[model samples]
Target chain A: MSVLEGINSKALKTGDLPPPSPSPNTFRIYSMRFCPAAQRALIYASVKKIPSEVININLQQKPDWYFTKNYKGQVPTLEHAEGKKLVIESAVIPEYLDDIFPETKILPSDPYEKVQQKLLLERLSDQLTPAFGRVFRAIKNPEELKEKFESILKAFEEAESLLEGAFYSGTSSPGFVDYLIYPSFQRVYWLTFLLEIFPLPSDNFPGPGYPKLSQWFKAITAIPEVAAASQSTENGVGSCKEYMKGLPYFDYGL
Target chain B: MSVLEGINSKALKTGDLPPPSPSPNTFRIYSMRFCPAAQRALIYASVKKIPSEVININLQQKPDWYFTKNYKGQVPTLEHAEGKKLVIESAVIPEYLDDIFPETKILPSDPYEKVQQKLLLERLSDQLTPAFGRVFRAIKNPEELKEKFESILKAFEEAESLLEGAFYSGTSSPGFVDYLIYPSFQRVYWLTFLLEIFPLPSDNFPGPGYPKLSQWFKAITAIPEVAAASQSTENGVGSCKEYMKGLPYFDYGL
Candidate 1:
C-alpha cells in the first residue's frame, strides 16, 4: 500500500495556525519535521491512511496559539471532535486511529495476538528509548558519550533478542512495534554521522553486537510509509546539530 | 458485578511458586501484597472475572527463578499462554485482560471513548504517580516531606480538574482511569497518616482543595472490586511504615 502523505507537510511555525485544520472534521497532527516522536505518529497515520493535516510546528519558536490547544506543547497531539477533545502521546494516537480505520488491520484482530504486539512495543520502548535519550544527552559531555553509546548498543542487543522474525510483530511485515521504534533506530543509525559535527572517539558499531537489529533496520526502512515519514540522515544531523546549539533550525530537510 | 477474588491471596515469600495457575487456561499474576502497581492489575483481573492465582512474592527476597520469567523483576508480571509468554506492566495487563474477557467492560469499547479513557489514565499516571513516589522517597528525609506533600496535593488538584462527572469515563461508574489511579490516590490519602509515624507537621488535607476527587474517592471505594482489592488504612500504614524502614516487611496486612 502506498503511504498517504498528509494534506499539508509544510514546516509551519511561530505565526502559523495549522492550515485551517483541513476541515472541521479533519484532525491536525502537531508536528516538527525532525522530531522522531512525532514521526512515529506520522508513519502510523500513513500506515492507517488517516486523512489529516500535518502542521510542522517550530520547536525552538513555538507559536503562541499552539499552547492554547495543547498546553503541554508536545507534538503528535491529535486535535479531533472539532477541537472539543485532544489526544496526545505517540502510542495512544495510533491505537485510536487503528480503531477508527480498521481496514488495513496492521494490529492483529484476535484478542491474544494484538496484545503480543503491544507487549513487544512496550518492551522496545523500555529497552531502546531510554538508551537513545542518554546518547543524545551525552553528546556535549564527550566523557559520558562512550559509556552511553555502549548502553545504546546493549539496548540494541536486547532489541535483537526480542526479534525471532524480520520484525518484532513476529511476521514479515512491519507492525506497531516496528513503526513506533523505527524513529529511534533511524536516529541511532544517523548518530554514526555525529563524528562529523562533534568528535573525540572512534565509531565502534560492532558488526557482531547487533546483527539481527541491523538487518531489521535495513528491512523496515525500505517500506513506503517509513520512506515518506523519515527525514534524510543529512537533514536529521543538520537540524539536530542546530537544535543542540539552541538555534531555530526547521529547514534541515531542504 | 461482584469482584472475583483470586484463588490465593496469601503473602508467599522467596521459594514459592504459584499454585497450579488455577488450571491450564488460567494466568498467574506476580504480585507483592502491599504494592500499589500490583493492586491495579489485581483489581483489573477481579473486575474482569479472571479466575487466576495471585503469587504475592516478597519484593525484598524475590525467588531465583522469578527473575528467569521476568528479569526486570517488577511486580504484576503476568504468566500466560502456559508460561510460554509473559505480559508485564500494570496498564498493558488490564488492556490485554479487557480484550480476552469482554464482560463487565470497564474500558470503553468505542474507539474514541476508549482512547479518552486511555488518555485520562495516562494523564493520571503522569500527574499523581510521580508525586506519590516523591512522598515515599521523602519519608527518611523529613526536610523534603512538606514540599513533597504539597506536590502530591497539586497532583491531586490536577486529577480533580480532569473529572467532569463521577468518573473519567464520562459515566456514572468507575472505569479504566479510575481503577489504574485509585492505587496512587489511596496511597496519598493514607499518606495523611504519615504524621503519626514520620514526625511530619500538620495533616492538611483541606476539604475544599480536592472536593471533587475527595468525593470521587469516597464513591469509587464503595465499588465491590475496589473494596476487594484495597487494604485497610491501618494495614496500609503499618505495611508502608515497615516498608519505609527497609526491613523485610511483607506480613503487615495482619
Candidate 2:
C-alpha cells in the first residue's frame, strides 16, 4: 500500500491528519494504522494483492474533509478513486471491496455457505466484539468483567462449533468470516499479553477448552497475507497501553 | 405470509410461545409482529413476494428452543427449512434472502452504487436508529433528549445530501437502503404520535431543512409493497403506548 504524498506516515498526530485529496482513478483507504477495523480492510487488500494507496488518519483530531467524506468520520472508509465515491462502516466496506474485485472472492461461492459465514460474522460482531471492546476500554468492574469473559467464552464455543473445516471459509484460503473476526482476535491477543485482564484462549496459550478456535487462530495468523498486515506484538501492546491511558496513540506515529 | 400451524397468530403470550417445529421444506421467520426490525424482514419478503411461514413469537417469553436457534434470542431469525440453517442479524437476513431469490434485487447492479446504499444504511444504523432507540427507551433526561434529537436531525440532513433521486437506491423502486431505514422511520413516527417526546420530521410535517428525506419518505411509504407491510398510524400509536406501559402488544395478537 503506497502512502499518499504530503502526509508523513510516521508523524500523524491529533491535528496532523491530512485531508482527503481528489484521487480520480486510484483506490484509497482512509485508515488509522492500528485500528482493528482498518486492519481488516488492509488485510483484505493484502490477501487479494490489490494495490491501493493507504492514507493513515488521526481519529482524535480528524481533518475537516474527513467528516465531509464520512459524516461519522470512521476509519476503514473506502474511496473509489474513479468516481470518488466513499463507502464507510467496517462491515460494509470489506464486502463492497470483495464484490468490486471479483478476482479474489472473500465471500463463499455457495449461497448457503455464504449465509452461514455471514451468520458467524454477525455472531462475532454482536457477541464477542463488544465483550472484547469492554475489556479494551478497561471500564468493567470485576463482576462485569467475569460476565463479559463468560460471554466471550460462549462466543468462542459457538465459533468452535461453526468451524467445519480448517478455515471458516471451509477452504484453504481465508474468506469473509476469517477476515471479519481476525482483527478483533489479534487485538485481544495483544490485550491479554499486555493487560492480563481476560486470558482469551489462543494458539499461544490454549485454554482448557475451545480447541478448534485456537487451532483456527494459529492457521489464520500463519497466513502470509495476515502476517504481512499484522503489527508487531510490542507495537500493538504499546499502542494499546496508550489507548488504555486515554492517550491518542497511532501505531504509524510510533 | 402463512402463519405457523400450532402458533396462534393471535393470543401469543410469554408462556404461550411455541417451540421450534420440525419443518423440513418451509422457510420460517420467527418474529414479533410489531418489531420494526422484524418488520424489515417481513417487508423484504413482501416486496420480493416470497412465500414463507411467519411465526409470531412472544419476545418476552421466547421458547427455550428459540435460544438454541439464536443465542441472543433476537427476532427476525430466518430458518432455511431444507438445511435448518439459521441466519440472524437484521442486516444479514434481508441480504441473504435477496441473494437466494435473485428474481428481485434489493441492492443495485452497479457495485459503486450498492456501496453508497450500504453507506446510507450504515448511517441509519449508527446515527438515526440509536437516536430513535433512545427516544423509545424513554430514559434520557431532558438535556440528553435534546442532544439526541439534534443528532437525529443531523442524520436526516446528511441523508438528504445522500439522496440522488426519488429513493436512496437512486431508482424508482425501493432497495436495500430503503428497507433498512424505513422501519426505524416508521417506528419514530409512531413514537412522535404516542409519546410526543421528539417530533421527528415526516412528509406530513416536514421539519425545516430535510426536504429530500421528507420527500423520499413520502415516496417510500406510497409504494404498494411498503403500504401493505405497514401498520396504520392508529395501530402503531396504540402499540407504542402499550410498549411504553410495559404491555404485550403484537399486531398479530391484537
Candidate 3:
C-alpha cells in the first residue's frame, strides 16, 4: 500500500540510518505514522500551530541511536531544539507542547476544568485503549471480541457523560482531551470498516450511543487542523489487516 | 486486625451506609490506608501542607455512593471543596493537587524539567508498577517472580540514570515525580521484607543497583513530610501477607 495522506512512510531498518534532516532551532517529534499515541502529539502540535518537524520512525526496525534518544524506543518522543533536550511518553509530550505554546492554549485556563479534561484522557488511556487493542487481538474469537467491544462502549458512555459542551474543553476549539481521544476513535472507524470485509458473529460496531459524544466527535473532526493532521482511515484498516495476518503491521509503504 | 495509624478503618458496604461526617467547606480525599496510589495523593497533600480531610474507605466493602462519586470505585479520589468537583486516577489527582496549590510547586518551573518529571512518573506507572504487581501474584512461582523482579530492576536503572541530583525533581524536596513513585517503592519495601519471611531462589531484592537511585531514595524518604505520610513498614508487610493468602489485602489494621 502506498503512503496515505498526512502519514509519514519513511522506512529506516538499519543502525546506519542517518539522523533526520535537522530543523535546527525548531522542535522535532519522533513519530510512527499509524501510532495513536504519536498521533496525539502530532495533532496537538498541528492544532496549536507550533512549528515542529514530525520525523517519522519505523518502530519495528528502529536505529541504534533511537534507543539512546528514548530508552523505551517509543514514538512521540519530542526532541527539543535539535536534541538540547528530549521528552518521551505521549501524555507528557502533548502537555509539554501546550506549555511551550500557551498562546494557543490546548489545555483550559481554569485549573478545575483542566484537571477534569486530564482525568478524562487518563481514563481513556488506562481503560479504553487497552480494550481497543484487545479487539484486534481477539478478532477470531467472537466472545472475546464482543466483550472487548462492550468494554469500549462503556468507556464511550462514560466519556459522553463527561462532555458538557461542544468539545471536551467545553469550547468549540479542540483541546488536549480531543487530541487525546480522536486518534483511537479514528482507528475504531477503520476497524469497523475492516470488520465489514471479514465478518464475525458479533461484528457490529458500537454505534454512538451517547448524543453528546456523537456531537463532540462530529465537532472535533470538522476542524481543519484535526482533519489535516489525521492519518487516512483506509491505511489504518490495511495495517490492522496485516496485524491480524501475523505480519509486520504498521508498515505504511512509503 | 486493628487499623494502623494514618489508616481509615470504617467499613461501608452499601448506599444506605451514611456518608462520613461532613467536613463541609474543606477538601476531602476518599482513600484506603494501604493503597500505594492513594498514598501518593495523601503524601502530596501532606508535602504541600494542603488542608484536606482524609476519608478512609473500606474498599473491599465500598459504599454504593462511592461508585457514583468515582465509577471505578478506586481510592485517592479527591472531592474538591466538599464535592463541588471530583478527580480520580492517582496520577491525575496528585497533579491536580499540585496545580491548585502552586505555592508549593511539585511540578517544576522549567517546562523541560517538568516534562522529564512527568515522563519518569509515566514510565514508572506503565512499567514498574505492573512488574511490582506481578512479583506479588507470582510469589508461588520463583521463575516468574525472578523475571518480574529483573524487569523492575531495569526500570530502576533507568530511573537511577534520570536522577542527576538529590531527588527526581533535581531539588532538595520531593516533588511530583517523587510523590508519584515513592508509594510504589514503599510497597516494594514491604514486599521485600515479606519475601524474607517467605523466601525463594534469586530471593534477593534489587538492592539499590544504581548508586544515584539509592541516594535518591534515601534523600526523599528523609524528608519530614514524606516520613509523616508513609504507612509503617510493619503494616505493609502484614497487608502483603494477607494479599498473598488470597484474602482481601490493604486491610491495614488502623
Candidate 4:
C-alpha cells in the first residue's frame, strides 16, 4: 500500500514497511542509552524483536532537528517511517509496539487487568522514576544516598504488600509491571553495588522483607528477552559511574 | 451479572464500571473544572451518568487526603470507591474510565487507532501539559509570560497543521484525541483570557483564526455536564492574577 493510502486507509498497524524516499531520515530513535526514558522505548523494541536504528543524541548539545521534533529536547523521539510521523515520550511508544505486534501481547488482555497494569507501570514511571533519579543523583553523599535508598526500599515494601503473588497482580508471566520494574531494578542494583550506598543486602520481601519480590525479579530477568535487554556487569560499571560523573550537581549532596 | 462475578469474569472494559466492592463507596471529585487531566475521567463518568459527588478543592490549602492519595497532590482524584482506590496520573485514570464504560466507546474500535489514540493522547499530555503549566507558573513574569505564550502558540500551530478537519484523526466523533485536547484547551482559554496572554494576537494560530477549534471548544463547553463541572469565572480571575501579582518576570517589555 502507498504511504498516504496506508494512513488514509487506517493501515498504521499493517503498514509496518519503511517509507519510500527514506534517506538517513528513516526510523531514527533519538536517544541517550543511559536515560531510563529512552531505555523504555528501546528495550521494548528490542524485546518485541523490531529493528530500530538509533540516533544517539548528545543530550547536552541537542541537534536542531531534535529541537524541531521535541522542543523540550527529550530523548526517545521515534521518527516513524512516514515523513514527519514522530512519536515522542517513552511510555507512549510502547503502546505503538503493542499495537503493531498484537500477538506478542506485552500488555494484559483483560481491561481491569489493563488498568492495573497501566497504574503499576505509571507508578514506576512517575513516582519511582523521580525518586530513583534523586537517589542516583545523591549517590556521592553517603547520608543523602542512605536516605534515598531507604525511601526506595520502603516504597518496595509498600509494593510488596500490594502484590497478589510472585508477580504483582495475576500470574507467573511478567506483563506490564515487569517491564516497568525490571529496568528500574537494574538501575537500583547498579546504584547499590557500584556506589556501595546501601550494599546489595539480603533478598528479603514479604517476610519482614521482600523475598517474593526478589524472587520475582530473578524470574523476570531470567527470561531470555529480559536477560538480553539487561546490562552486563562490565557495562554497568562503566555507564552508571559515567552518568554520575556528568551531572552538574554531583557534589552538592542532592 | 453480579459485580464480583463480573470483576472475576474479567469481562469489563477499562474505566467502564464503578469498580467492584461489596458496597459501592460514593465517589467525590476534587478538581478544577477546566483541568484536562481531571476532564478525562470526569467526561467519561459524566457520559456514563455514573453519579459521582463533587467537591471543588480549594487549591491553596489542599485537603490532607489529596496529598495522601497523590503525593504530587494534583487533582481529579476519585475517592470512596472499590476499596479506596487512589488512582493517580491522568493517563492511567482515563484508561480506568474506559475500563468502567466500554459502551461509551470513546476510544476508536480499531486496535491501530486505539494505539494511535493512546500515543496521541500521551503526547498531548506530556508536551502540551508542561507548556501550559510553564505559562501558568510564569504568569507573574510578563516578559517570560509572553515567551511562554509564544511557545504555547507554536504548539497550537503544530496542532493545527497536523489536524486534518473536524477532529485529529478518524471519522469517529470525539474519540481519544478529542477528549484529551478538550480539557487542556479549556485550561488554555482560562490561562489566556483571565491571565491576559490573549492568543488572539498570534499571527499563526490566532485563537479566533482557527474556526474549527474555536467552534469545537464552544461545543465541548456547551455539554451541560461539562459546564456544570466547570469552575467559577471569578475564582479563575482572582487566583490567576493573584498568582501573577508579585512577579516581574511576566513584565516582558510589551
Candidate topping lDDT:
1
Off by over 4 Å in 3: A1-9, A140-148, A157-162, A197-212, A242-254, B1-16, B20-25, B140-148, B152-155, B197-210, B245-251
lDDT of 3 by residue, A54-94 (tens): 66777777877888778888887888675778888887787
lDDT, candidate 1, B1-254, per-residue tens: 43434423566657776455335686788887778898898889877777766777777777777776677787888787677767788888898888777776778888878887887788788888888888788888878887787777777678888889888778887889888888887787677676654322223332456677767877777778677777777888788788777766677754
Error of 4 at B23 (Å): 6.2
> Which candidate has the top score in TM-score?
1
What TM-score do all the candidates reach, one by one?
Answer: 0.91, 0.86, 0.86, 0.70
Model 4 has an lDDT value of: 0.59
Candidate 4 is graded, for docking, as acceptable
**TM-score, cand. 4:** 0.70
List the DockQ of the predictions in order: 0.70, 0.65, 0.74, 0.27
Q: Least accurate stretch of 10 residues (summed lDDT) in model 2 chain B?
A: B2-11
Scored by CA lDDT, what does every candidate get?
Answer: 0.74, 0.71, 0.71, 0.59
Clash totals for all models, in order? 0, 0, 6, 30
> Mind giving the per-residue lDDT tens digits that candidate 2 earns over B50-103?
666777777776667677667788888887666368888777788888788877
Better of 1 and 4 by TM-score: 1
Q: Is candidate 2 or candidate 3 better by lDDT?
A: 3
Model 1 regions more than 4 Å off: A1-19, A196-208, B1-10, B17-22, B196-206
How far out, in Å, is residue B73 in model 4?
Answer: 5.6
Model 4, span A124-167: residue lDDT tens: 55556776778877877887787777667766766666566778
